[model samples]
Target chain A: MSKSILFGKTLAELNEICKQIGLPGFAGKQIAQWLYQKEVYSIAEMTNLSLKSRELLAQKYEVGLEAPIKVQVSADGTKKYLFQAKAGNFIETAMMPDNDRKTVCVSSQVGCKMGCLFCMTARQGFQSNLTAGEILNQYRSISEWAEITNLVYMGMGEPFDNIDEVLKSLEILTSDWGYALSPKRITVSTIGIIPGMKTFLEKSNCHLAVSMHTPFEEERKKLMPIEQVYSLEEVIEHIRAFDFGLQRRVSFEYIMFKGVNDTPRHVKELIRLLNGLRCRINLIRFHPIPDSPLQGSDDETIMEFKDTLNRKGIITTLRASRGQDIYAACGLLSTKELVKKQEKDY
Target chain B: MQSLNPVLITDSQPIANKAFLLQFNRTFIFKPGQIIGITTQKEIAPRLYSICSTPNDATVSILYTIKEDGVLTPQLSALKAGETIWITQPQGKFLFDGKPSWWIATGTGIAPFYSMFQSGQKPLKLIHGGRTQNDLYFHQEFQALTDYIKCCSQDSGNGIYAGRLTKYIDEQESLPPHINYYLCGSAEMVVDVRNLLIKKGAEYHQIITEIYF
Candidate 1:
């Protein structure tokens, strides 16, 4: 049998591993430093540990990290990297360089189960959830790892759906013994699974972004099926109830579709729905997919909608479209062609 | 945000191969298509199941199939009468609007539609898909409907269409444009069926889906 991975283990879990392996309790911190701080690729590379201890550790565990197998670079300097997941499934991560800040978007699952009508990832169907190791490898294995200043959980699948691993990844990213990243530099996006969202808010301090494409309940039900299970009303109410101090941020992602959700009524409803919440609205231009009935709102309509929202006291910004040629933009990240079919229960 | 309430199992019985119907006394009011959250223990996360019994029934019913590796269903399948379980108030927006519509489902996705049908909301057409004829859980109850269609992909039987549900839909000349389409199934089935319906001339807004995540 293959050994379990140690890269994603928390400090307490590593301590337990030390006890099971008959190593000194402090060896757990040493292993954590080797796996996370130094970010070693092989167990043999931990030169500080005694050879006997290293050999015993290697017998049952590995510092699991897989490098990206494929990278697609756009003319505009956006790069999309494909990594083979531990289960042999594929996931995509995109690195965008904007002026001084470099943002790396990471995926939480192989594909997605959310089945949003406009998402390319949903078209692939859900294959499997990525372990915390797989989720962090996207950041640690990329070429721009040293320079990355921002991380967004906006790549392929819904982060909240895989909340346990997503939270683990967040902890490893923010904990002192791990990546030591500021929680403010990271943002996790979701289509509003209420239970997962509430848990995330209560446990982690990272920023939250909700995919609220339309404010109308009926129209949102058609675009995103999660509305049927956890309504947008409930999601907003949960957010309203939470106390997100001054530094932590909350934002709404609205993908503008022509004549469908860019109408004036949607603008008014958005204002009413988000009246008191201290959050920003990101207006994303929809990128058309194969056989999709929706179209992106024209530039004029997008600007007018942004102006209307801004005039209504909501901080709305039009996100600059990036990596369209390489399919790394919003709603366009998918590994469908590379996905191998798996046996589904239903 | 409703808390889970403890309820005792009234009955549990196998309805088909690997599928079971579980019953408990109804305590909370729910629309036919809404779902209830159930858990064997308070510490474990609850799984949402559509109420498969009618509103007027004295007991609430949940239809489920045993997934060997699933956390809840195997335990739920092994429960005996008088055992205790936790359930939350019914919730969700997959309710039938009492309109002319088509109900499409596969496997245990048939639960919500069964709830609506038992509640006396007859759909214009019901397209149910399964791997074998025996996979159809409530066929006898639906057989009397004039527009009921069954698509069995693996095994053929009398009066059954011998292909996948998407294939059956793809072969259609055009789908009805005015009627609503309610799809409850796995992500693959819902996405495939929704795309096919759109390609066959149905409006995207006319389709509402509830996928098992």
Candidate 2:
């Protein structure tokens, strides 16, 4: 049986898997091609491998894409799919359809670790990183399969902390023999993880968007706990090293809060902090969730804030809020549905 | 879990060593810069990719770059035309509003602003930057949008400005006052340009930036 090396298996792990299956040593790359490139659903589809090799693979490992157990459609075209994972825990993925494109939002972890004060997924805490297959299935199990045009890793967790698995999934998504998307189409957002940011910059050609809701370091910590460990200052410092000067883009996600981070002082400070960096600020209207300490800024305030940034010469715009009525907007997603199912099981 | 029907790969190709352009027919409307989800015929679903082409285009277009040791790209490469795949609808806030203006971008960051130029909304100037001449995608299309299409090549020798876009704009003795700077590309470039334009006394209301990375 080929051992299940779907997690963070380095090249050495692949070599051992190949040796046990009695294939030539170089076949490890071929295995990688299948796992990361071809992204086949089963060993049967590994036609390039010998029958004996395929048999050995089938004995131990199973390709990871699992189907969602249930699907819920929002009034708007957003559809959320729920799936039960290896340990019986569940996660959800969202599919949103617009005129020219189909966008699927996928989860990286069963739950999230970054306890941003307003996020429900963060309230669930971290479960575990998803296997490459499980992560891949979010794309595989949906309608209008042939019409998808873009991908954003903005669903459930902090992709950077789950770096290895996320990187592998990204490899499969962009590999020449795999999903083969131009890196520009795929954007992975993080709450400022230094190590992961560096790795992503060095490795992936895909775009990067940082979750920088507040330019002020101290105020930012109130909304996102990770601000303590990896300061926005450090995140910017690391990003500045790489030249996004060309096609590569760096954007800061600024969620506007009514009386909190949306003041003229706040906007001016945002301009001051980002004075030297070449980046854009996405002024996201704070999505209201139950018991959140913050309230969303009024449209007027958002516009004024955007005006200040634009006036100051930092390109800024208000991000349109979507899926709010369905608890599907930013920071509004909850696994309470799964929690209810678990209570039923009990 | 039910097995998904095969993904219909409408078209796929490697535009660069790690980037790809995957096209498919959309039964729905998609606005430019909206990120949509995709499920391959093999049953693997990845996150949303931003739409590059204008919604008016018949076929949907996605421009993506390869991730190092990433999984999605390899799978995307194996696809051929006519294979089944899953795509979500368009989603995002980065697009041209009714206000007419100039468009600026760095590298592949030019994708979102692609529609802005295609529409020919108003008098426009597209200033794009890349490390080399070949890195510039959609150059001719941008040139068609404005007579002042400035290409800033940082590494390769085929441009007037050898360094950054900010440097080139800084040297602009007389940019029109009403010109709205629609900037896209890397965060660093966006930040630098914003700071410089403001320092040079450009009004913040006249500048709009869509962060690419």
lDDT of 2 by residue, B1-213 (tens): 112333356788877656688888766776665556666644454444667766787777777766566567677767778876766545445556656566767666677766555654534566777655555666666666545445544454433456556667778886777767666654345545655676676654466655432
Q: Could you give candidate 1's per-residue lDDT for residues B1-213 as a string of tens digits?
A: 348899999999999999999999998788988988998988878888888999899999999988897889999999999999999878898999988999999998999999899888989999999998788889889998879999988868688998888888888887876999999988878988898899889999999899887
Once superposed on the true structure, which residue ranges of model 1 sit more than 4 Å away at CA? A86-88, A330-336, A343-346
Question: Docking category for candidate 1?
Answer: medium
Task: Give the alpha-carbon lDDT of every model.
Answer: 0.89, 0.67
Instruction: Assess chain B of each prediction and give its TM-score.
Output: 0.97, 0.80
How much of the true A–B contact set does each candidate keep? 0.61, 0.00
Candidate 2 local lDDT, A138-254, one digit each (tens)? 776566445668788888878887777788778777766456777787888888877677888888888889998777865775566556446788788778767875787788888
lDDT of 1 at B9: 100
| CA lDDT, candidate 1, residue A287 | 86
